[model samples]
Target: MSHLHIPDGVLPVWLWVAGWVATLAAVTVAGRVAERVDVRRRVPLLAVVSALMLVAMSSEIVPIAYHINLTVVGGVLLGPALSIIASFIVEVVLALLGHGGITVLGLNTLIIAGEMVLGWALFRGLVNLAGRSRVRLIAFVATVVTLAVTTTALVGIVAIGGSGATARESGALDPATLRFDNPFSRGVFSLGLFSGGEDHGHAEREQHTVEAVEDEQGPDETGLSVGRFAAVIYTLGPIGWAIEALLTAWLLGYVAQVRPGLIWGGHWQRSGGRMPGDEGTVN
Candidate 1:
């Protein structure tokens, strides 16, 4: 859920640079895992799955900032190793569309990757516990747990990042930019999307582009208190989680019935648009 929209200048160069380093390290780890698993076959599958996640994240409902992440969905289908790369790809693509800071791409990757991994972890266990009898319940619980962990991680990122921000930068820092009270908002996910206050009521924005919210030079230093920021995050987090959990669960249940192999371990196939396994194919 942590797709923080703060433009390039808001974050210190050191911090964003560090983010890139960490992100690259993660990608390296993902690469190692993929090589062991079978890079020749999985790369094509990874691209297709990553593109799907990109579409879901990009399709923002302007009225409410709700966009499907399908982070867990990727984890379930692609496994944690490939999902990290997939999440990073989604973040980079979103930056190209001007939805987020180019400098902070690595950080956003870390946040989203956390979601993908946790969702995979929970679902891997829960799917076993539920067996084949209660697929929906297991999915619902896994998604909710994933959201909770990711959202809480969002707060930690904001708190830490905000603390490292330039305190004396001469710019207006508006906390109201969050717009959490608005009925039609991005909801908890917006915690990941918030930047130096962009007018979000433009519900009809073309899906292909995102207006750059950060200043070309840098973002204004945030003056939002950690206590207040955390308070708002906690307040809005549960609402968004519950809503997304239901949606995610429904999608998982549907997928389970149609392509059981996608959810559980199945023979990996290389065909794009479909994942064929011993159980069945998902197309």
Candidate 2:
């Protein structure tokens, strides 16, 4: 759910470039902070978390319109700093696999990193407020935070892409004038996964017609106006965000109760200066 499928060159250049810069800055800060910490000891664990993210995101449940990327769980376990780096690495690999666009990598990374940081913060705060034994509370807070962050980022992306216009105005963009039909067709193509095979051939033919018209018009003239584009993006992305949050909350909550040691900073361990047998018993 944290992954963005927006293609390159779809969004205005400024918005795309700005997102890239912000993500770079964030990565730099996270890297520096991680360097001072015992990251070497966590390399194997980080690899595992990255692998989990890759697999989780790959298994798409068609009806839900999105996949579960539970890097937030990793964030809660490894802390936000390390999770940021881990998410960045995973996103890069996913992009190479054609799961997302290269130009939008920065924006995608920032969104996921936001989820990681917010989830960790929520986890830490809930553990402190309700006491560590209230495992359900911790999971609930983490899930809520993850949803909120992901939703906010989706809204931000819509706003940035200038898709917030009303339907009439959004439809004003002539499909016949587009440079590439991919940008205009992305929304429908994405939704096609949920629609089943009934209209598949028809949709492809229509998409082809639109692409032909757009090809004649050249690149600059075909995309929707900023307001209209933003509106479309805002309209579609939130549902997936909510589903992911609920799933993450339930899964994490169960894990917290069954294996409390996984709830970072909750169960004191020998390596962190606590006694060996004290593991699993919260402070």
Candidate 3:
């Protein structure tokens, strides 16, 4: 729900520059913190989770104009430090693939990393309060809350970006319903999977769709105000969040049952090195 999908030269220079600086600092800190763990053992898992996130973020669900970000899932599996690193890698790749512009790379990374960190913290804290037995419920609640917070952050970033920080191409939003109209009508549920920006056909179709919407809506006075933009996001966001939360819950529950250490913290063996303050339980 938080993927920017903005093109280059859109956001102001100051905003993107600040985003780059902050992202670099976060990644540096994440690298240093990651050194405390036996990162070698988790390298493969990191790669897997990063790839999954890439796929999820690249594909837009047609109806809701939303994408599933398995960032919370990554956070649960890889923890905060590694998840931050993964977020950077995923955003960089997404930019290269034309999911969002290179200019917004840092900002996008920060948003996704926020989700990972928040989700990890919430899940851990909730587990402590509710107990580890309810892994599914904990993951669901954590995912929902994390997405809500980060989506609000995304809206704030857009508001700060001035008029250029629209969620998608101009006139794409149906102001009355605050939902993006689906240009693709092949199916009720469609996955515009990784069309990349290079798809000439898809690009043409998108242009036509925007023009058509503009003609139908007549003159647009809304002009992408924070209030209207936020309405569109909030209207669609909860649905995506619930779907993602369920997916997170089912996946985390299975992982917790089979390999509890990954979710609970540390390794199954004492030699694997435990995180500070973590209750390392050997399965």
lDDT of each: 0.71, 0.67, 0.77
**TM-scores for every predicted model:** 0.73, 0.68, 0.73
**Model 1 misplaced stretches (Cα beyond 4 Å):** 164-166, 169-222, 267-283
Report the error of model 3 at residue 184, Å.
Answer: 42
Which residues of candidate 2, in runs, are more than 4 Å off?
A: 164-242, 266-283
- Give lDDT: candidate 3, residue 204: 57
**Best by lDDT, which number?**
3
Task: Report the C-alpha lDDT of model 3 over 44-124, residue by residue, as the tens digit.
Answer: 667888999888777777899888888888887777888889999999888887677898999999999999989989998
| Clash count of each predicted structure | 7, 10, 0
Candidate 3 ranges with C-alpha deviation above 4 Å: 164-223, 267-271, 274-283
Q: Between prediction 1 and prediction 2, which has the larger TM-score?
A: 1
Which candidate would rank higher by lDDT, 2 or 3?
3
Q: lDDT by residue for model 2 over 226-267, one digit each (tens)?
A: 555445545655666566666667767777767656664422
Clashing pairs in 2: 162-226, 162-230, 163-229, 163-230, 163-231, 164-227, 164-230, 164-231, 165-227, 178-222
